[model samples]
Target: MRKLVIAISMLALAASAAFADPILDRQALMKERGKIVGGISKVVKDEEPFDAAAVLTQLQALQANAEKFDADALFPSGSDTGDTTAAPKIWEDMAGFKAVEDKYLADIKAATAAAPADVDTLKTQFGAIASNCGTCHQTYRVKKG
Candidate 1:
């Protein structure tokens, strides 16, 4: 029984070590951001009624997500390896990478202040932020299958 327990514990430790913590953390943050965007997207798509308050809440969450992201902490050296989709360009031009995130935060701030009262306004705000996301992904992400 003691030997079996030791073997199981060793397996658990190895399994946990298989994925680097930073990659996992960053991936989780991105996934949450996607969900927040999806919630707002439903309103933009007319799949859900335009509730300015609800949209504002989601926008706020997005703002928090942007605020919480620290590029250096999330993308440390050697984090580029493993199963990450982060482009090498991110490491090469960290300033540029940070600029991209800064632009995203600015868009969020602008959108929050505007506080869209209708679908059209929300669409415009969404477009600005979405465009920022697209730009970053294009320059800083690699599509790994």
Candidate 2:
């Protein structure tokens, strides 16, 4: 009985960790993206000195995350609860949502390749990337107060 209890307890813990809420997962991912972009934005806004190398590194990280972002897996069905900002339309119009996601990923890839050398170029390229994010949020993300 003692051994069986321990095995069940371990299994329960593993299952819970393995099935962590998808909403939380996406939220954390978005926060990371936001932090990276925010760092670049500060430089572009002249709030910080423009460092091409730093910008490139941050953009690379964003691109890496974008490349690995799998909405279908991360935004699983019935995960639009908790603190999720995902709208119901995501599950209803999955293809449309995916199209937007694809565009964002493409924009990130382009930005990574461009590696804007100065604030002006960074603004232009990063503007497109930011716009892509806004477009998706407008359609699929619920506003949070």
Candidate 3:
């Protein structure tokens, strides 16, 4: 009986780990996006001198990541647990959530194509991109304590 209990416990642990993987992957992806955004923002805010090439590279990366940010795969039904800041509403209103994601991705792609050549251009483009990001976060993400 004790051995059976141990086996059950192990199975539960493995199940939890498997469930946690998508959450971890989503968090890591978001962090990467944040870092790229921050880097671009610094130049836009004059906190860093403008580097057109670097900004372009970061924008390209943002577009690539946004393209790969598959909400369906990342936010599976049981993914709300374990380090995830995704609100339950994501799964509840899956269509709305996906629309927001699609909009954000579209905005990112537009910004990438624009390839801001100067600080002023970057400021305008980044503002639109950031606004789209905030919109999704406001509706879909839960603030973590």
Among these predictions, the greatest lDDT belongs to: 1
Candidate 2: tens digits of C-alpha lDDT, residues 1-145? 9999999999999999866868767877888989988998898789999999999999999998887688877898878777777899999999999999898888889988988888999999989889988898899988989
Q: What does the lDDT come to for candidate 1?
A: 0.93
Q: Model 1, which residues run further than 4 Å from truth?
A: 1-20
Sort the predicted structures by TM-score, highest score first: 2, 1, 3
Q: What TM-score does each of the candidates earn?
A: 0.85, 0.87, 0.83
Greater lDDT among 1 and 3 belongs to 1
Candidate 3: how many backbone clashes?
A: 0
Error of 1 at 107 (Å): 0.5
Better of 1 and 2 by TM-score: 2
Model 3: residue 41 alpha-carbon error in angstroms? 0.8
Tens digits of per-residue lDDT, candidate 3, 73-117, equal 889888777767788889999999898888888888887888788
Task: Tell me the whole-model lDDT of each prediction, alpha carbons only.
Answer: 0.93, 0.88, 0.86
- lDDT for each residue of candidate 1 in 1-145, tens digit (9 for 90 to 100): 9999999999999987765488988999999999999999899999999998999999999999999899988999989998889999999999999999999999999999888899999999999999989999999999867
Q: 6, model 3: CA deviation in Å?
A: 23
For model 3, the stretches where C-alpha displacement exceeds 4 angstroms are: 1-20
lDDT of 3: 0.86
